[model samples]
Target: MLLLTCPWCGPRDETEYHYGGQAHVAYPANPAELSDEEWAEYLFFRDNPKGPFAERWVHSTGCRRWFNVVRDTVTYEVLAVYGPHDPRPELAAGDPR
Candidate 1:
């Protein structure tokens, strides 16, 4: 019953979106030289935060762009939505806004 507000598509049912995992992840400069463990770590590991977290989500049934979403893990509350290249401004320390 969570309402996910997409940046380009407006509010939508959660089922229409696909979670794209942590945003801002960059590939290594020298990927050819990476060890197996390093490669696996980059591919599988993530800092799974508990509260308001920034993540990537695709509006699969709508605009189809992968955008960033700030949401609460515990209550499934959506905070904000922005495009992939958006420069997220710093919100107040405790406020979700």
Candidate 2:
């Protein structure tokens, strides 16, 4: 089983958490001014990268707090774990998104 380290509760099984999809997605500044396509894009579109990606996760069974994780999609290896408000860290020279 995969293990995720929660910012508040430390390491826990992946089952103890909830995946919140891609992180760092910004809300539209003017929702009312958006066209149908724009609204749909904002709601459903997300990056599906093959390598390291930033994602949001919530520790449901533990502290029940949200946090961010930079993980490798192909290997399922977590590169970094950080708070929700923290900026994404710089990956190593060989790491790619």
Candidate 3:
């Protein structure tokens, strides 16, 4: 099974957490003025990048807190984890750290 480290609870089984999809998605500034296609895109569209990506996850069974993780989509490798409000960690070019 996959293991995901919670920012507050440390390392734990992936089952104790809930996937919250892509992180850092900005909400529309004026939803009322948006067209149907624009609103739909804002609500449902997401980039499915092939390599490493940032995502949000919640530690439901543990601390019940949400955090961000930089992970590789293909290998399921977690490169970093930080609180939702914390700035995303920087990594060297070509490095996952």
Candidate 4:
């Protein structure tokens, strides 16, 4: 089972959280000016990287707060956890921290 740490509640089972998809996705600056294609891209497109990726998760069963996590997609290893407003951490390649 995967283990995830909530920024507000500390470590807990992954089952207690809800995946919020790719992190740092900003909403379009001018929604009304965007074409259908652009709107669709903003809503659906996300990076699917092979290694460590920044993602959003909500601790539904605990604090019910949203946070970001740097996790390895292939190994299912969580590297870092931070609040939603915090900046994404810079992780070195091959570093297993």
- Pick the TM-score winner: 2
Best model number under lDDT: 2
Question: Residue-wise lDDT of candidate 3 within 48-67, one digit each (tens)?
Answer: 98777899999999999999
lDDT for 34 in candidate 3 is 99
For model 4, the superposed segments whose C-alpha errors exceed 4 Å read 93-97
User: Residue 96: error of model 4 in Å?
Assistant: 9.8
**Tens digit of per-residue lDDT, candidate 1, span 1-97:** 7788887778999899898998777889999999999999999999777877888899999889899888878778777788898876465687543
Listed in order, each prediction's TM-score against the native is: 0.85, 0.94, 0.90, 0.92
Better of 1 and 3 by TM-score: 3
Model 2: colliding residue pairs = none
lDDT of each: 0.83, 0.92, 0.88, 0.89
Tell me the lDDT of candidate 2: 0.92
Instruction: List, residue by residue over 8-79, the lDDT tens digit for candidate 4.
Output: 788899899999999999988889999999999999999999878999999998999999999889898898
Candidate 4 lDDT (Cα, whole model)?
A: 0.89
Clashing pairs in 3: none
Local lDDT at 15 for model 4: 96
Candidate 3 ranges with C-alpha deviation above 4 Å: 95-97
For candidate 2, write residues 8-88 as lDDT tens digits: 888899999999999999999999999999999999999999989999999998888999999999999999999998899
